[model samples]
Target: MDDTPTTTRPPRWLNDHEMRAWLGYRRMRALLDLQLARRLAADQGLSEPDYDVLTSLSDAEDHRIRLSELADRMLWSKSRLSHHVTRMQQRGLVTRQECASDGRGAFIVLTNHGMATLHAAAPDHVAAVREHFIDLLTEDQLRILGDLTDTVLAHLREQPA
Candidate 1:
């Protein structure tokens, strides 16, 4: 006969509705990411990471931003960003300029080639977004989803990295 004493409470678990909702969200996120990456690669000859870097540069003022800032914006480590930037530089998509003020710092400037590539890719990328995501939802659903995303983003930002 076993005579072990237990004082632990059962763990709180998701109920049926919550479980369904959570699983749906996970499935949707995964599928959307995969589809978007595949579309970017197949249609634009750019990997999702490459597209991300290019878009970030395109959005920055003067089509340039400090290398550290770029890494922060992309949530990539310094080493990873540096390696990717090196690859891009080799392709003539971007150039690394030494910061005049800070000898140790560098700026990532999108080149004409990069700008042209982004311009060419933008139309198809927009179409893919519309086809796979935007058109799938009603206006009200889109608004609600945006609000939900903002809320979640706020919560996430409040947490420690």
Candidate 2:
């Protein structure tokens, strides 16, 4: 039997407007993330992943969450999160506690130091966000961007994993 797969039709290529939008979004995402990460590291001594993990724990109930759950929420693999958590733990930013109900499970708890660091860093981060991104857009543009993202995210969530 033949094993090669065949398509019924040729692929549709992106036109000028679609290509512009796609490339613009890619460039913007890359540049914005780089700028934000650099500012966070320079001013706060925190990497972007560190900030994300800290924020996730802070938002959770009692400032703690299961390691697996946190990994899923962050869309990170278990191993990656575990290694990162270990680094944060060494810094006294967070700690790991055994889950009593599950022998193999652990919880990542944000420490007081982590909370303090987040509080200290938040103002500067917000200022940088405003300076680099939010302030550049008009109210209408912001609203449209929000709507567009919501639409895209909704569509993405509807797809099979």
Top candidate on TM-score is 2
For each candidate in the order shown, give its overall lDDT on alpha carbons. 0.91, 0.95
Q: Give the TM-score of candidate 2.
A: 0.95
Give me the overall lDDT of model 2: 0.95
> Candidate 2 on 1-161: residue-level lDDT in tens?
99999768877999999999999999999999999999999999999899999999999999999999999888899999999999999999999999999999999999999999999888888898999999999999999999999999999889886
Query: Per-prediction TM-score, please?
Result: 0.90, 0.95
Off by over 4 Å in 1: 1-10
The list of candidate 2 runs beyond 4 A from truth reads 3-5
Model 2 poorest ten-residue lDDT run: 2-11
Tell me the deviation in Å of residue 16 in model 1: 1.8
**Root-mean-square deviation of each candidate, in angstroms?**
3.7, 1.5
